[model samples]
Target: MNAYGINPDPSEITEITPAVDGVESIPLPLYGYNVSAGFPSPADDFIEEYLDLNQLLVKHREATFFVRVSGCSMTGAGIYSGDILIVDRSLDPAHGKIVIAVVSGELTVKRLVMRNGRAILRSENPNYPDIPAGDELRVWGVVTSVIHKV
Candidate 1:
């Protein structure tokens, strides 16, 4: 069993290195007014300031990385198959926090749970079971934010 508490399915996971090559920080104009999703409101033409996503999303540049999710195991936690997750290695993997972990060399994303003083990686979906994190489990990073297009 892997981090999902079931036999590891090779097709259900994929690991990709964060794309930082030739990527430069660009500051975009941030508006002051908050857009309403419930109904359309009059446009407020106010420029707050220049906002850089790198500075906002990433806390520690060296310890932070991005991962593309590839499975529905974390759907219950609002993470979809194509979501981009911002993971920070410097943060502590506390209980109930979603994390990207490598179990026996296999990479998987799940919530960290404590059971009987032992760490167990649990899936957000009820279809999956909780996998006991033994000595071989290595936490890659803690998920700080998830981004997906509406």
Candidate 2:
């Protein structure tokens, strides 16, 4: 998709990369309290626990994979180009979930919407058209997390 969040070019393709196993865990200090965003508040100095990102995000280790988004089809969902999406094959393709799917042999990241026994891939951007699932549609996984560089 372009900057306007419309007009998805067929040539643009999202790439999927399997999550690597056996990487050493690096635990980071995690504060116990939630920080206030709208007002200034007293901050906690003591660390409550150590947090491992992989442990927090990945529910099923062996069934997870990473996919790099290549377009703005999902911009409305806060997903953008170059963002890494964590997808889990073990999760059910429930309605309203963003998913990594293979449509006509191409990998795509879109929301799955089930209606009256039919399923369609819905783009987050309104300008894009919804893709009705057919024989070629294959749900690869349900997108669990999106890692973005701030």
Strongest candidate by lDDT: 2
lDDT tens digits by residue: candidate 2, 1-150: 432244543423467677778978889878767676653343556568889998988888889988788877888999888888999999989999998878766788889999999998898887778888788788989999999987
For model 1, residues 1-150, the per-residue Cα lDDT tens digits are 653456773323455656364669999878777776653343445667889888889887778888888878888999888788899989999999998888878778999998878898888888777778778787888989988989
Candidate lDDT (C-alpha), each = 0.79, 0.80
After superposition, candidate 1 runs with Cα above 4 Å error: 1-5, 9-13, 19-22, 38-44
User: What are the RMSDs of all candidates, in order?
Assistant: 3.0, 4.6
lDDT of 1 at 81: 85
The number of clashing residue pairs in each candidate reads: 0, 0
lDDT of 2: 0.80
Best by TM-score: 2
